[model samples]
Target: MKSFSDKLLWGIIVLLAAAMAITAAVKLSPLLNPPQDISLPLNAACDLHQGPCTTSLPGGGRLEFSLEPRPIPVLRPLRLQVRATGIKADSVEVDFAGVDMKMAFNRPRLVSGKEGLFTGEATLPVCVRNKMAWQATVLVEADGQRIAVPFRFETKR
Candidate 1:
């Protein structure tokens, strides 16, 4: 038969083991199950209006994103272009999202051109504020999987 002190010692060890496991699980939760919406980060200083910004894809490949009409006009037909390399893509799309506020759904499927170039057009809704921040998420679909690269830009009225 186990003595009382031995039983208490075993119980304490088991409780500590459980506590350590829980702590590890809590600390590593985000790394284990990353958020699904996470996309490739774009440089904060990058100016899509001035020129195209290029970023590497998750697995492999390079994506060049750009918005047209330097200064990025609002309520006017805006041109969007993306040049991607090193991946077989089924389709490409650009989803516009307002950073400061929620706006109507605006997603445009870009037409593929020669040599992995995709182009599309869209009109941005007028914002109440003079300057509005926006995020353009480029969605690339291939082999039943989708990859997104997000670019942030601001529009001035």
Candidate 2:
């Protein structure tokens, strides 16, 4: 036979254990089986000199990408800017990579500026060849979801 206080203490301990177990399961479920990501292709042909290029995002939103200075020079400071519309984003980052070659360290996290605009500075690495193709992947985080938009272009020396 147990006292009333002992029974109440045991009951509280059981409830707390149950709550912790539920929290752990919710956090680990994603690691157990990750969700598949969908890639959205930009329809517009982006030329570095022309002006800012626009693209439609998945769901309902728009993304505008631009770079300062035409013909994108290597080993120099380049300004990368993005303007997003009809979307709520907490943060934005650009991941720069070579189309064919492997570039391990070029991704720079952009800081938000003004309204719906994010800007960052990044430098492209010089390749052995005079010409190289690069991809700038913009990652937007909104409402606990991350979306990636890729812009491809070629550079020449």
What is the lDDT of every predicted structure here?
A: 0.84, 0.80
Q: Please, what are the lDDT tens digits per residue for candidate 2 over residues 50-87? A: 77788887778989989877767888898999999988
Q: How many residue pairs collide in each prediction? A: 0, 0
Candidate 1, poorest ten consecutive residues by summed lDDT: 30-39
Query: What TM-score does prediction 1 earn?
Result: 0.73
Q: Model 2 scores what on Cα lDDT?
A: 0.80
Best by lDDT: 1
lDDT tens string, model 1, 70-148? 8899999998889989877778888888997998878889999988999999999999999999998888876667777
- Against the true structure, candidate 2 reaches a TM-score of 0.73
